[model samples]
Target: MVSEIHLSDDLGDSNLTVSDFANTLDAAIRTLLEEQSTGLIAGGKISNKLVELEIPEKLVVIGDIHGDLRALHNILKKIKIDKFVLNHNNKIIFLGDYVDRGLGSIEVLYTICSLKIQHPHSVVLMRGNHEAPVEFPISSHDLPKRMTERFGRRIGTEIYQTKIMDLFHLLYLITIIKGELFLVHGGVPTDLSNITMKFNEIVPNETGLFGDMLEEILWNDPRILPDGKDWENSRRGLGKHFSSNVSKNWLSISKTKVIVRGHEPCNGFKLDHDGMVLTLFSCNEAYPKFSVGYISTSGIRLHSIRNGFDLSEMVKIL
Candidate 1:
């Protein structure tokens, strides 16, 4: 049997101090930086902002927490994360957007950081559009304001700039599970003609197309158009709205069957591109009408799965 680790009981604790939160962020950032420098994470290789993993025995995917501490706690409890990670072959991937729009942003981030620090190899934290503001600033960004409300002006602003921003910079942009699945916060890259380049070889911060690819990976969404158009400017004003053909071409070029992402709000989960893409929305507090959901599956099952529609049976709704 694998040794079990204990998680903190104060997930959404009301009395968490600024110092504690800062310390947790500091530890998580250090771990991520080390992973980047060494190019190793959870027995997988890291290339720039992409993580390449040879499918784990079990994988749990959580999407867009958005400061929903209760939802996070519920998912963790439902999955029995502490016990699950004990198996060593079990992994959990958080699909980013961990902050903003909810009252418990700090608490939610604190819990996630603590989890990452405890099980560095078992947890993968991917960057979402909300976390992309460090490079591509969003006008409606409110994580700093949430921090200020929680810890007062000076301390909150200090921590947000020093620790939180550093953490965001260290978050992974994409995680590819070998020949099985392509996991990202948003949708597929629009320019599939040049997508023959391996994802691991692409540098996110490089100028020109590489930079644009990073932006699209973090901000893009999927839509089915009546016309034959494959790409269009996104209303969000950052990434493009890619059509079903875009997803198919991208998946075929990347040698992956499905694109699992978290961006659009839906009733827990939604399938796009004729079941070629799976969009998971895991927080109810951010959009109360939508139910929170996550994907829990074994790599064997995921690898054998045909498309997103068949994968829906594995989603656990909260």
Candidate 2:
């Protein structure tokens, strides 16, 4: 029979204190990291600790970075991106899941945090479902176990530092740009009221499973838009495509303005239904795979998204 949630009660000497966890977990992670070259893992562990950067022009948005630092860095160097959005307010909203499934999550967070510091007012960093503890359930193959299996205690402890925990606390952070555009990591929750509230109210841990209304807000996939205006849920994976129906619904709930988001990967940067919404995935499969995406809301003629990430017909954007 399969093991039944073998999570340990100890979590080693982490930077941030988790409520409950076993101790051996840190030892395992340290062993793994050492066996696999602790030096490199140590470098990656600190990648997401950046400080400052240039301001964005108008706005720039990125998608699931998935720890691909090479790809992320390449895109940053090539994009000549502006970090601030002045008139219509240009900013970069990382759709979510900045870490895992790849490498370099540390760097991705550092750059994002760096941008946050540089363009404090213009930088609108939001959270993805991956930020939720649920994403790292004891059953995960790469996390907890693989992470523990590699990366040793020192590196693992950093993963739970004040920086990461703080980010998780506000994982559901959002911004209703111009009171029209609702900028978020995933799709707006099925419960429209949740979106109407502040960012922390929808944070999973902070509010727990109470009347907080986060399961859907932080977890709902946009692909499950109502079919034929039926308002039904689709079986798309958590990485569901944002349906035109969802766009329509979000528009109505937020007053028929454009809804820009990042969750599922498109060819690269794409604009649908006459610029009503846009998606700019920053990471690309090529270039150490850093080809990232962004949006430019300048000139105010129509919303335009920019990116170094490309589409090779591998993704399905239902």
Candidate 3:
């Protein structure tokens, strides 16, 4: 059974220390786990492969956060959905990479989890490649290593296991909104048609699952199709490299109008395959470019961040 939870508002504040996250780790984990259980039970399905959500009146789709709390906060506040805007009519779909590379992975996660607890039905969290543990020699800042550096070995390791690891297991691979939009951390998988998989199938608990469709969803990249092939093996060495033709087929099969994903960074946002796919990067410091997407009756709106976290004009994706 799922339980209701309340976390201190301070957990959502930026510029937090590892100790701050450690103090609230247990409560946050309990709440996140309960939310996952409740959502699964209420959804009438036991699966991790996908999560189906009804498109709310107003929907916001954010790209890779990568532990940038200031960017997250700025985007949320600009859209008036910060810590207090808990209206059920509005929904936020985060494309993942909630940790790694930035300084505030702990606080970024706490804020997201707190939002989930407060608005259980309104927020949808998707799994990203960086969510799981990466091996040594990887370039970016991973959760375990960064936390250990900040909080010492024992406390950091425990905090990671209790607060971060389980949440990664609980996250879904894809979210289908109103049967019109298909959302995932990465692009489509070539093996998506091989199995008679339900909307929600069980996914692997960790990354590095070679050839797993769920892993593909979390790792794939979109590429323009060449002469006659549908897809080629990905250069990333894990997921498949999908082409526009592949995307069209998947869109037709799934009956979704467009695919929105985040994995590769872009100049705020990028439209592909003649507007059938959108890749957005929401973290400003990720590469000095940032934006967020909103799906409304008016179409997809891309809000760019400028002048150190100020909101710019809303550019419609065409």
Candidate 4:
């Protein structure tokens, strides 16, 4: 039998070899398949698709890291100094796309997994478009190719199966903070209320059990239409690009203040519909500039990590 999930000891220690990763991958896959649960193991924290959080204290929200270990490390270093950010009350929410399109996909996965094991309740990892089980031909940089290049074909394939995509299914697609801020990998659905109740039913596997809704949540984008239209067909040929009015209607209906998402790698950050929607892209290599959002009692503050940590340009979304 696979050993109990215990990669928390490996955090900040990059001593794990590719073979070691393969072993961990095997164990994780066995754990996931056998348990048939959302948490890492049986009776663990987290559920499917939606992680509801109480954001009474400070919460650091990192946008898409892709696979840039450097940027991820930099953000971690800052978090380390803060000291209180990782406490039980607060949280560190990653807005997904943790793998693919960068050099350190495997390392990034290991790091995030370790952190999750260490802080099961405090650390939240959401599912991104790249996190889907099926291969995405659109990604310019394929993670599987990178894995194969690093550990050769056999070990790489094993890693991809268990260590990467399997865990993606366990990730919550939408994380609501204080029933106010909505966190999703992509834009929110036009009809947020209807889907919120049925989100757990939309589990994704190789066959895509609920592929259409999954595609919309993971692939959708936000747009501003001339009239007070709700949604329009996206140019991407995948999901709808919701209009400003759609977002407003959803926010009002859902009783949420703002919607935050990461997918388009939008020049580090983008605010739409008078800041009702915040799009943050945190991969520095793919997108040279990067920023992280902090949700607190004060409001949402966007801090730039481009040259260094600058909080002067913080935007209040409350």
lDDT of 3: 0.63
Q: Over the stretch 195-255, how does candidate 2's per-residue lDDT look in tens digits?
A: 4453334322324332433434444444434455423453533333445655666666555
Clashes of 2: 44
> How do the predictions measure up, each by TM-score?
0.92, 0.58, 0.77, 0.76
Which segments of candidate 1 are over 4 A away from where they belong?
A: 1-13, 198-200, 203-209
Worst 10 contiguous positions by lDDT, candidate 1: 1-10
* RMSD after CA superposition, every candidate: 3.2, 13.1, 6.5, 6.5
lDDT of 4 at 231: 79
Q: Give the residue spans of candidate 3 off by over 4 A.
A: 1-20, 23-25, 40-49, 82-84, 133-141, 192-211, 289-318
State which candidate has the highest lDDT.
1
Give the range where candidate 4 is weakest over 10 consecutive residues by summed lDDT: 303-312
Evaluate all candidate structures by whole-model CA lDDT and list the values in order: 0.81, 0.44, 0.63, 0.63
Q: Would you give me the overall lDDT of model 2?
A: 0.44
For residues 129-244, write the lDDT of model 4, one tens digit per residue.
88864655465348778878778899777877666667776666776764457778888676555555544454334443254567777878988776857778887766788888
lDDT of 1 by residue, 12-84 (tens): 4476766777878888898888877788776588776788888898999999888888888889888988788
* Model 3 vs. true fold: TM: 0.77
Comparing 3 and 4 on lDDT, the stronger one:
3
Poorest stretch of ten by lDDT in candidate 2: 42-51
